[model samples]
Target: MTGNQASAGHLLRLIRTGEATTRGELQEATGLSRSTVGHRLDQLFRAEWLRDRAGISTGGRPSTRLEFDAAHAVVLAAALETRHARLAVFDLAGTVLAERTEPLLLEDGPDKVLVRLAEWFGPLLAEAGTAPGKVCGIGLSVPGPVDWEAGQVVQPPIMPGWDRYPVRRRMREAYAEHVGPVSSDPLPVLLDNDANLMAYAEQRAGFRDCGAFLLVKVSTGIGAGVVVGGEIYRGIDGGAGDIGHIRLPDRTDALCKCGSFGCLAAVASGRALAGQLSALGIPAASGSGVREHLAAGRPEAVRLAREAGRRVGEVLATVVTLLNPGVLMIAGDLAGAPFLTGVRELLYQRAMPRTTANLQVVTSSLGERAGLTGAAAMVVEHLYAPDRADARLAALESVSREPHLSPGPR
Candidate 1:
């Protein structure tokens, strides 16, 4: 973040983050001469990453105001849940142009799932009035812990048969097979945990200024995602927020999908609640079913949900105390009044007064769409990051000279 005005990428980042906007501001921010600043900005303009405001009067002539141009490319983002998938085409600015939700069973395995995803992108792009060549990257949100460098899930309880899969390669191959090649080099595919994406989306939307933010998703399974200093806190090996597997006292009889007993998810996850409700003859099948019951004012569902919240809250007390996040967002299926009330009741009582005093516990604002937003943001951030953007600019220049680059899909 220092003043290395030599990097055109650094200048672009300054413009994107609003640290600098005009030639003079760029010079002042980066401590570079006006000529050097203009030279760097010229690179950004040539790469189509920046634009100039033509008629802005700054106390005299029309001032040169720089802006990051987000209309030059598009991104494809998808969120995969246990029983459904949501995919969308977004411009670089995070605008959802075309989106669809369909039943996509995760148990179908990665090969089938990734191919189906690749096959869907072409139509989604056409619907958004874009071609495959216009896509800068793809982002995927999965309901499990992710090995980001390997670009695959790691022993996810909900997502079986996907451990150590070469997701990035398989996804690109599927796209080339179904949609055909769009460029000389392979397109970038980014993947992350669903709860992490949700937390990221929530943080970016409303709590970007908050230094510490926590989002707990209580759906078919329970999980937590933390955003610290405006970044996802994926602990070493990306297992930082797997709170569901946390063991609890005396709940050994309750079995978890992770093949363990006395875990938090085993006691309080949506799957666990659904099982309890089914045993009580209520016929609740999944988290969504429990949500439907809650919406219909089923007292039993309400009671169970509240109790589940309390149990989750019990675990979260330690988390909140440890992280001391400014915002604690409750998301996913069980994020309504009963569950939230239960969480608040227990969380506030156990955590220290200082921790609870500054914490703002709230429900989701973006709901299920949060995953899509997060995925898109992840792609945008990764592709547009300073170092990567510079590399991409170099590639663009190299691509321009290559006569064999494909123009579009079949």
Candidate 2:
């Protein structure tokens, strides 16, 4: 490989991913000379991004195994729902240092919610004993489709004022306002759909070997996330898995938030069931409220949720036929046994036998924290990948060369 291509960051990525743990293995994998490999390893070691551990003896001398030091950096993550938000400070390895969930209505608009998130970050960082400079990047999970390239939400149904919002810039400004100016640079902010992040996290943690993974989130709105070959399949312009807007033939009168009639979400979403319950003298309003009712074993809520699940399952029948996912996961507030059973009743019955032969229908194992976990993982992976990692390393090295300035705060 060329010198510009085989950088210290590239070598570190190899070690971080377990692709090559020893110098000899790195040399073999990269086709670099031993001296070139040694130079790269030294740079990584000096940056504290890599450490060495004793390795098993093979022949002449035992090789030292290189390992990624996850504690070298931290990530800030937030998952914003329609009615509430969850925020956390995580290490590079996706371990939560400090986290909290609080009520913050999305309809309040981007400025207010983002400022609140910034306010929360201060205490969270202090509580975790993480300094501002230690934060490598930030990740935000929202309940809408994201223009990943633009770092903005695009035409969200529930989030009225957030269409094409400058989420990343506002978040960076709020963060600076709350935490004071960062030394090295403003932290990179990344955004994605909540269901997409949840599905990505679940598949990586449990079903990494599965070539195709699908997850349906049955919350205030219904959305699906699909992962194929370990990568999220965001269709052209990030609108691939918007199964909630799929129209149902029989529910012609149901009106969705997106101004469409007969949309699946209008009939089968948590919001729909809550409205049905409210009409029947119940006080349900949000998806969380529906979850509470379900937990209490309310007969009407249970029945309605199951019916919703069946509707979702009917739609998923086509998805299964098209994607042929090996693992179909049910997540969000309505991911309980009754709902899953109803889904199975429709999905297995309607889908082709060949599709269902090896499909495994399951519930979310990460529960409510899946989005947060996935957000952190996304940030870590993005910031530390080979190409990006080299730039970051160069920035760090340049800062180090200036003897007057130490490596930013943490």
Best by lDDT: 2
Every model's TM-score: 0.96, 0.96
Candidate 1 lDDT tens digits, 19-80: 88888887777788878777777778877788888747768888778898988888889999
Candidate 1: which pairs clash? none
Clashing pairs in model 2? none
Per-residue C-alpha lDDT of model 2 across residues 331-404, encoded as one tens digit per residue: 99999987898899999999999999999999999999999999999888888788887787788888889999
